[model samples]
Target: MIPLYLLHITTVEHSESLLWTFLTCNVFVVTAGIVFMYKLFTQKKVRGAGIVFGIAIAINYILIAIFGDPFDLLG
Candidate 1:
């Protein structure tokens, strides 16, 4: 994610196409993560790391939803 953010910061000024690509990929990845987590939850497979990951994703999603990008807060 940091690499993608860095790429965005570096290339966003040079290419609108890359910017759109980045947005599309980001959306796809986040959607995929959500679906995967839902499947894990439904299947009762959320073990130790899964529990940590799910909680982290949920917190980040909530923070981003309410605050309009809270990655800086995470840092």
Candidate 2:
């Protein structure tokens, strides 16, 4: 809700669809951080870190990979 709250604070009239937009972004980031940190703490290989980071980035862009647009922030 940071983006929406910030936008709200800034008083910009963002599309109402921003509720989902922010949710998706938060889920992507939180999942990545949790999974990556888990693997980092559990795994021994240095590659684990790399893979985690890559997956984190990939998760954020998975929509673009499949849907074409970067993020459907509006709708």
Candidate 3:
């Protein structure tokens, strides 16, 4: 999904891509993590929740900078 946004950014004729990057990454992380957290909550492995959350956030920001807007989007 993040890659898809990047590809979209490339073909979209110079517009802001950061918004999309942040939106897609965070939304996916939060949504997937919520389900994962709920499932693992039953197992009492609460620590796994923090680790997963951190990983998700880390990856998103990495991708965000890699695929962020090129300043031309402001036009």
TM-score for all models, in order of appearance: 0.43, 0.43, 0.44
Tens-digit lDDT track for model 3 on 1-75?
A: 565554334433324566665566677788768967786867766676667777887787566446654442332
Candidate with best TM-score: 3
Full candidate order by TM-score, most accurate first: 3, 2, 1
How high is the CA lDDT of each candidate model? 0.52, 0.54, 0.61
Candidate 3 residues lying further than 4 Å off, grouped into runs, are 1-15, 44-54, 63-75
User: Mind giving the per-residue lDDT tens digits that candidate 1 earns over 1-75?
Assistant: 555565233321434554456555456546657766786778855565465556656665553445333443343
Worst 10 residues of 3 by lDDT: 6-15
lDDT at residue 28 of model 1 (Cα atoms): 53
Give the lowest summed-lDDT range of ten residues in model 1.
7-16
True-vs-predicted CA distance for residue 34, candidate 1, Å: 0.2
Q: Provide the RMSD of all predictions against the true structure, rounded to 1 decimal.
A: 9.4, 6.8, 7.6
Question: Residue 45 lDDT in model 3?
Answer: 63
